[model samples]
Structure formats: C-alpha cells, structure tokens
Target: MTDSIRHLSIHIDRTRDDVYAFASNPENLPAWALGLGGSIVREGDEWVASDAPMGRVTVAFVPPNDLGVLDHDVTLPDGEVFNNPLRVITDGTGSLVVFTLRRPAGATDAEFERDAEMVTADLARLKELLESA
Candidate 1:
C-alpha cells in the first residue's frame, strides 16, 4: 500500500555528465542525500554505511554510464529494500535532476509530505553543490 510516486526535480547550471557523475557516486551520498550522510565504504560489490539508520546498510548503484540513468537500491539492516529511481537530463541551459520518492506503506500524509520536502531539499543541495563547483 505505498503512496503515490513523488518526483522532485532541480535544475542545475551544469552539464548532464557532470551532474550525473557527481550525483551517482555512492561515496558522494553524504554530500547531498542527508539520510545517508556518512562516509561509505565498499563491501565487495556494494557500498556500506555503518552509521546509517537501522545500523549498517548496503547501497547498490546502477553501473555508471553516459545515459544519466541513476537508479539504486538501498538495503536496510533489517533486510527491507528501497528502490530509488533518479535521472539527469540535459536541457538547453543545463541539466535536470529528478528523484522519485515513494511513501512507504502505512506512512501518514504528513509523513509523506515531509519525505518529499526532505528529498526536494536534498536535490536543491545537490544543485547548489554542482552549480557552485
């Protein structure tokens, strides 16, 4: 019973490649994704963050590419998996980074909105970081 898919996008005055490269790196998660704000270490084929919610978690990102497909799956310590869909598209002036956020089952409306706001802020942070660089 997940809620609607919420899309939060931010326009950055940077090339699509640059934005995608920076945003897609798991090591750079803390610089933008507030929820996983910590130094991530490689665990075999995945990235693991020990200090994240539910203790340690594993993040497996889609292989980097030029097409701007930035999808990843986060595995919680309790074995729940959250799939995140993200993308970067080039426009005339710059790039558009879009993140798809979904409300987990049983989340209240307020909680869902709060999650959207957090993701919106995170995307804005990523835009600022990239545009400033």
Candidate 2:
C-alpha cells in the first residue's frame, strides 16, 4: 500500500497571485525551503535543482492555483538515495504543501515521519515570509 499523508487548510495573509509567483519560481526555493542547499532553475517545462542533496531535481507538475509537484532523488550524507515528492495546493486562504518521501521499500517509517514534520515547519515559515511581505 502507498501511504499518503495530507496537510490541508493552512491560511496565509496574501493574494493568490503573490503566493503563486513566490512558489512557482525556482529562484525563491532556497529562501523559504529550510534545509535546501542551492539554486533551482527551469529546464524546458521542469524545475531543476543543482548543488542540492538531490544533485538534480525534476519538476513533475505546475498548475495555476490547483496544484504543483516536484520530485528529486536526494543523496544523503550517509550515501543513501531518497526519492522525494513535494506537492502543493491552494486552500482558498493559503496553501497546503505535502511532501512524500519514498525510501527503500524496507526503510523504517519513523524517519519518513520526521522528514514530513520538518517540511511542515518549513511550509509554516514560508507562510510567515509571504504574509509578512
């Protein structure tokens, strides 16, 4: 079974266009993405990240207000490669961002949960930055 976790109904004080612009641009990723290592860019229709743990990431989807998804194969400090999927959705008021990490099939669940928590906090930080600006 593919387990999925959802974080819905976050509210931020910003316009839809402002939020969309911030999230859609690859340049702004490091600004709000807490542990992100380096810069991001667009290669054709996909967003790509270089110098990050992932080495290079590909954007899976980008939509107006309904959805956006990014994926990467990240190399850990211990030399483990993790497949990371990030999803975002506008929730009328703010946005709901979900990050799903797929490790080796036999990997423990605890670490994945921890990673999800970290991403959730990062999203909260993003909300603060956008709303405050």
Candidate 3:
C-alpha cells in the first residue's frame, strides 16, 4: 500500500488561539473546505459530521496551540473508501496542515494529484480567513 501525504503551510497575521478556534470548529469547515456540507456534532471527545465526501469522521486528537488530528473513512465519487488522516500544527506563528491518505496498494497517481490541489486551495482559504479576521 502506498501512503501518500500532502503538506500545506500558510502564514497569517493572527494569534494562535484565534486561528485554532476558527479552524477547529467544524461549523467553519465549509468556509474553507470545498464540496462539504452538514454540521459537525461533538460526541464526547470526537467530532462527527455528515454530507461529506467521507460519510463520517471522528476527531482523533486536539492539542492546545500545537496540533489536531482527524481520522475518517473517506468515500470518493467512485465509491472508494480511503482511510484519511489529517494533521494540523502551528509553526509558532501560523500553521501547517497535512493530509496523509493510505491508499489500497496500487492506487492511481491521479488520486494524490487531486488531493494535493484540493488541500492547497483549502490552505489558501484558511490563510485568507486568518489574515482578514
């Protein structure tokens, strides 16, 4: 199985707490994420959401001003379930978010390319939000 990982980092002129609060809240996801819908509900330590490419996602980890992790079974348009791990970290000034997808051993290269573009655009939106907020 080839593990594909994509990294995106952007600097914003905002406090760490502000950035974290905005990004961590599921309600703000659609503001940055494309083609995502539904609200995020917190069940104990995990956050759940629907109408996403991923049927449901669980919050994996959330650390103060440092990191947050999310794990979920993501279904593509072709009905493929991809195990995705999303990690968010602060650069002590801004933040860097990465998405690592574990594809079925021989996944197509297009998969990585598509996700990279999507994630890059998401990061750009995040940067705009943080800078303008």
TM-score per model over all chains: 0.93, 0.61, 0.62
Instruction: Give me the runs in candidate 2 sitting further than 4 Å from their true place.
Output: 1-4, 63-104
Model 1 earns a TM-score of 0.93
lDDT by residue for model 1 (16-111), tens: 988888988888998888777567889898899888756888999888787999999989988999999999999777999888998888889999
Tens digits of per-residue lDDT for model 2, 23-121:
666678777765555676777766556556645544333344444554445444455655666555566765665556444555467865776666777
Better of 1 and 3 by TM-score: 1
lDDT of 3 by residue, 23-42 (tens): 76666877886545556566
Pairs in steric clash, model 1: none
Candidates arranged by TM-score, highest first = 1, 3, 2
lDDT of each: 0.87, 0.60, 0.61
Model 3: lDDT of residue 99: 58
CA shift at 68, candidate 2, in angstroms?
8.0
By how many angstroms RMSD does model 1 differ from the true structure?
Answer: 1.7
- Model 3: colliding residue pairs: none
Sorting all predicted structures by lDDT, with the top scorer first, yields 1, 3, 2
lDDT at 104 for candidate 2?
A: 52
